[model samples]
Target: MNIRQMIKENNRLQDAMTPDNLSYYQDMVVYIRSSAVQERQCEELLLEMARRLLDAQDKGKDAKDVFGNDLESYCKEQIERLPKRKGLSALQYHLMIPWIALTWFFFVQAIVGFVTMWAGGPVERMTQVRISTLILIAGGAYVLIHVLMKWMKSDAFKPEAAQRKISARNIGVYVAITVLILVAGVWLGRHLPVLVIAPWVSLFIFLIGLTGTKLLFSTK
Candidate 1:
């Protein structure tokens, strides 16, 4: 049958089935949708599977009997049998491991830094800061090495296309901001007690580390 015909049949079955059967069919639809099948193929397969499931329900069989004990696994096997489509290469996943590890390391550093600043004695705080810094540096080096390795070996690791040009006015604004921050930092360093500045600096570092880590690990 055509895709539309199959879909209509499935929907009719869905309407006719009991709530429990309907729920199982809905989950099957979700699994099929999420499988690595091509869009057109997925639609056809989903409807086909739904129709079969409905047939089994009509015969008084449970979902497990219709789709086997593991419906998702069955659907995945079927999807894999379809013709190959474009997907992420193994290199992409290999590169992601180091990146994700680095992101998690920085996240942990941020948490440790904050906790140490709030709870530790002077010596303990200094020690924690040093340890966190070392961890951050090590994690960064590991990620950089993996990134460089991928860049050397794979075209897929190359940087994306350039974004919009920064206008002359934006450059001037950025310079002004940099100068303002430097001036503020110097002023604060000279006027504020170390104890007062230290906690804020720690907090600022924690926030930046957390944000950078989150951005690095965020999925498209």
Candidate 2:
């Protein structure tokens, strides 16, 4: 074939060898034509695409592994870049936040439960109203915790930030604890006021323990 005629035939054949076709002869011809420009080996692109597909499958199994690593890396960077004038040490400050959150939850729940009990158990048909209310409050708190975690997770380096997101979570836990205490108090208060004092004391104990744990871990 003449030079121009041969070039035209090659162009037509090259255009026909798309990835989806994987035709051997067509691929060989295109590979030769585009050798200088797209010098990748014949299967290079296909192999890379296969790797990406496998990676995607792995991510589907544990999306957290991909995003969580990024988040934790980001948090480390932020801590390292701090201006040093934030008062408390970075470790100390973040550590104490969870403790403070737990304490606040304990106190709030203790009060809510105490007040709820003091208002009298519940009406006849509304006997389960208190339980329902407590459940709703707890569910709402969980949602809030989830949202807060999602937002803080934007930092990409603080993957563990979500683990420490107990502010709203404490509310739900303490609320349940308080309700248990209130029920016990109501039952035992039939004879003495001692039962009324247990929940608060328990809450205080939990706060102390939580605070201690935070300090110990953060100091490391």
Candidate 3:
């Protein structure tokens, strides 16, 4: 199965677990999935682990007894055993992320065009977003998302310290990043050309993106 299919299957199996068991299972899921291990390997391990836990639960087994107390060590051992991708191998074939992102971006622009037309504006002048501004926006979005995801996964295994409150410092950092991105985007947008994308072109790009995802998201 593909990574997405395995992930869906794993999640479905986890629903059968007792609340306590599900919590324990989620710890393993978030940690390994957030790790540098290949996505396919993580899904495979999680799928097998979910099935094992369900079986153990049926026999009135305690999760701690079966998996032991050291969640970190157990997960690390499994990560080590799985095949590791070296250098570019780890970086390749993960095009679904960008493909889906761009698809949604264009799809939204097309929707905006529809909104403008309903208001009796020219569809050709739907958006005034410049190429450089788009790049800055996309880049900023990626960095912000990466930071947030890291914070989310950092304490996955440490359930005791799982509940995190955003402090003033964190808030300040986020605000600063937002301000910087806005400043850069505005400057670039003024200097660069406002290449207005026709709604039809955006729709076409969205269609192309759909085909790109089929080739990227699957190994076949």
Candidate 4:
């Protein structure tokens, strides 16, 4: 029978069932319908399941016996066995990457600017320097994260070769990086003359950094 007929029959059976039976049937239908399987295949699967339920009920078996106790888990297991559909196309990725990168860049800058202003960096010039420095840092970090993500996806970077255990060496490396960043920030704060740098310079650097990040991240 066609899917439409099967659906009508299933609805008729559901209408005749008890409240708890109806609820269970509805939940199972939802779980299966939400899966990535093709619409025709999903409908056929549901139709078969409904037929089995009706048969079991006629034999005087409980709903739990007809469709197991854990319907959700059963549905998940079945769906997992289905082959995955192809993900977004390259064109879609290209369209989306710039927007995603811009979002991250803006979010990081906003947080940095808020914290700097709250910390009482002089509103006139020092605040601008701090904000500029932060924008550059954030841009650099954004590029780094994308680079690392790419590297992680490479076949050369096998899961087995990855460091599963965190050791003192890793902890020490992190600490060293943190210290260097703090030192660099302090040095810039002290040595960089806030007034000597034009406001346009910061804007230009930010724009350049943003463009560089987009290019670095968007390339395959």
Question: Best candidate per TM-score, number?
Answer: 3
Q: Write the per-residue lDDT of candidate 2 for residues 1-220, one digit (tens) a residue.
A: 4445555544554453333322322322332332222223323433332343346444553323322334334334433433332245656645454554455555665565556567774322222224333333444445455555554444223223453675456567668766775675555445442222334563675577566756665423
- The TM-score of predicted model 3 comes to 0.67
Number of the top-ranking candidate, with lDDT as the measure: 3
CA lDDT of every candidate? 0.57, 0.43, 0.76, 0.59
Clashes of each: 0, 8, 0, 0
lDDT of 2 at 6: 50
Model 1 misplaced regions, further than 4 Å: 1-12, 88-220
True lDDT of residue 4, candidate 2 = 57
Name model 4 segments beyond 4 Å from true.
82-220
Residue 71 in candidate 4 has what lDDT? 71
Residue pairs in clash, model 4: none
lDDT of 3 by residue, 1-220 (tens): 8988887788799879999899888988888877777778888989888888888999999678678998878988989888764323334333344446668788888889878878898766676557875677467666777678866676566655434444445578899999998898878877888787777788888888878777656543
lDDT of 1 by residue, 96-182 (tens): 554555445545655665666677645344433333333334445455556444333332212223111323444565576556655
Task: Please write out the lDDT profile of model 4 over residues 61-103, one tens digit for every residue.
Answer: 7668887777767777767766544445565545444445554
Q: Order of all candidates by TM-score, from best down to worst?
A: 3, 4, 1, 2
The TM-score that candidate 2 achieves is 0.24
TM-scores of the candidates are: 0.37, 0.24, 0.67, 0.38
